[model samples]
Target: MKKLPVNCPSCEKSLVVSQLSCSNCETVISGSYSLPILLQLSSEDQDFIFEFILSSGSLKKIAIKLGKSYPTVRNKLDDIIERISQLQKS
Candidate 1:
């Protein structure tokens, strides 16, 4: 089985899913199926978000684990939070 391509090659644009098909039955359902808002984020932001969650929202721990400055980790977390909030609103 081939994995579905999640990003556009030409422009590197994010691809949103519009439908899901059942391979066995050949049944298709189509509607507004948006990708989880987090999927739209950059890889770095996603990693930061994952670490933030795994670290139980501790900035100090996240900074140490990521080998980054506390301020840098905090800034990335803030950015991801803002993006998540925006996605929720939209």
Candidate 2:
């Protein structure tokens, strides 16, 4: 499935979840709900996090899985951490 956008394309502004639906029941609900800061990250970052979870947050495993060096993976993780910190404060 394609990821839903978390930001406006033209304005590059954060977006809120205004509507939700149930695929099973076709029930629709509408309201303004802020997305978690994590969801606001880029899809690549989100995927990295998913992989991190799959690896049980093991940086070594993540590095090996991605065919990257441990330092590279660690730097990626540091960047993710910085982004999360900034997002949480906003």
Candidate 3:
């Protein structure tokens, strides 16, 4: 399945979920809803988070899996944490 876009193509602004539907009942609902902070991240970052979880939050394991230095992986995770914090405050 294709991932849902979190930003507008032209304006480069955040996008909201305006409509949703039930596949089973064909029921539909519409409203303006902001994407969750985590979902607002780029797909690559989301995948990193997934990997981090899968590795049991081990930076060394993640670094090894990505073939990167442990400090590099740690820095990347730190950056993601900061981004999430900023997103939460907005």
Candidate 4:
């Protein structure tokens, strides 16, 4: 499946979910819905989150898997955490 776009291509503004349809019943629903905070993150960030989960939230394991120094991985995670906090506030 194609990744969901979080921004408008032309204006670069964040995009909202405006419509959804049920595949089973063909029932359509329409409304302006804000994208979840996580979905609003870049794909790379999302992949990091998936990796973090799969590693059972172990920074050491994540660092090993990414072939990165432990401090670098920790900084990356810290940055993600800050981004999430800001997103939540907005």
Candidate 5:
């Protein structure tokens, strides 16, 4: 399945979840709703986070898994941390 976008492509604005449906019941609900902070991140950031979790939050393991240098992995992690912090602050 294709990933759902968390932001608008044109305006580069965050998108709201306005409607939801249950495939099993065909029940639909509509309302203005906000996404969690993590879900608001770009897809690349989300993949990095998923890998970090799969690596048990170890930079060394992440570096090895991604075949990147340790410093590079660390830097990426640092950037992700700052981005997440900024997102949460808003």
Candidate 6:
């Protein structure tokens, strides 16, 4: 089966699913669905998050793998943290 498009094209953001349909009965259900705040972040931020997770939250390793200075890695991490907090609140 083909997967449906699940992200915004222009911003590359994820789309929240809030509706379901019953094929046999032709019944449809809908509700409010909010996209996670993290999806509002830039693609770079998302990549940083993935890398951070893969590196097991090790700043030194992340910095080296990303070929960025330690301070840069730290700064990126800080930005990601702020985003996460905002996401949690929303």
User: What C-alpha root-mean-square deviation, in Å, does candidate 4 show against the real structure?
Assistant: 1.1
The candidate, 1 or 2, that scores higher on TM-score is 2
Candidate 2 TM-score, true structure as reference:
0.91
Which predicted model would earn the best TM-score? 3
| Model 3, runs deviating above 4 Å | none
Tens-digit lDDT string for candidate 3 (23-80): 9999999999899999999898999999999999999999999999999999999999
Provide the TM-score for each candidate, comma-separated: 0.66, 0.91, 0.93, 0.91, 0.90, 0.60
Sort all candidates by TM-score, best to worst.
3, 4, 2, 5, 1, 6
Of 2 and 6, which scores higher on lDDT?
Answer: 2
Question: Over all chains combined, what TM-score does candidate 1 have?
Answer: 0.66
Worst 10 residues of 6 by lDDT: 1-10
Score candidate 6 by TM-score against the native.
Answer: 0.60
Q: Which of 1 and 5 is the better model by lDDT? A: 5
For candidate 2, the per-residue lDDT at 30 reads: 100
Best of the candidates, lDDT: 3
Candidate 6 lDDT over 28-85, as tens digits, reads 9998676666666667787788898899989899999989999999998887788778
Overlapping backbone residue pairs in candidate 5 total: 0
lDDT of 6: 0.80
Superposed on all Cα atoms, model 6 deviates from the true structure by an RMSD in Å of: 5.5
- Encode model 4's per-residue lDDT on 14-84: one tens digit a residue: 89999999999999999999999999998989999999999999999999999999999999988999999
| lDDT scores in order | 0.81, 0.94, 0.94, 0.94, 0.90, 0.80
Error of 3 at 40 (Å): 0.3
Count of residue pairs whose backbone atoms collide, per candidate:
0, 0, 0, 0, 0, 0
Candidate 3 vs 6: which has more TM-score: 3
lDDT of 5: 0.90
For residue 2, model 5's alpha carbon misses the true position, in angstroms, by 1.2
Q: Mind giving the per-residue lDDT tens digits that candidate 5 earns over 1-90?
A: 598788889997888999999999999999999888888887888999999999899989989989999999999988989988998887
